[model samples]
Target: MGYMPTEMELIELGQNINMNLGGRVDFEDFVELMAPKLLAETAGMIGVKELKDAFKEFDMDGDGEITTEELRQAMNKLMGEHMSRREIDAIVKEADDNGDGTVDFEEFVRMMSR
Candidate 1:
């Protein structure tokens, strides 16, 4: 069953863009890929207080920091219903200019801006 992306698979998947998922997914068979895992299945959402609060859910380390992994987790939770990993990664990269793997709260807030 397809599950958490391996580091290598993540790299390979990141190399190409899937237009269907809005240039986020690379899998030629995302449906087959996500089927058994049921990654795409969800009930619904209630309310999103703010983007920062949404981000905090994955900031396990706290310290007002959010890493790519954390961001991915959050993206999966908040945006999984709409976007794919590649799109999420691209958006995350916009804020993580240093590519240090962490986005402080200030950076987090700044990055989500238009």
Candidate 2:
């Protein structure tokens, strides 16, 4: 069987993605927004459609947006681990556009498909 990724490796992977996204607001807002660095360490190295579907899954309220709480819960449920509240807030703040305190589909796509 393949080896499991360590927690530090996971955090580094997240940081790499966040960095490559350049803290953008949306994919259509500018060039290279979707040019995010892909990490092979992630589960099966998913594609854009799978990534978007994952984002939709995170939007548990079906509100077309993912709040920090929703992201936190999704992480816990899917990854079987709890993320710190601060980490969740940081992630939301990183992708939040229009300052609405949430990541919309555009932002989510831009962040993930990067």
TM-score of each: 0.42, 0.57
RMSD over all Cα atoms, model 1: 15.4
RMSD of each: 15.4, 12.1
lDDT of 2 by residue, 1-114 (tens): 133656885576557557865554453532232223223323245565776688788999999999989999999999987889999999888888568999987677656634
Which pairs clash in model 2? 36-114
- Candidate 1 global CA lDDT score: 0.56
> Each candidate: what lDDT?
0.56, 0.69
Q: Best candidate per TM-score, number? A: 2
lDDT per residue as tens, model 1, 30-101: 644443223222111212356556557868777687766677676667667445667657766787746766
lDDT of 2 at 22: 58
| Candidate with the greatest lDDT versus the true structure | 2
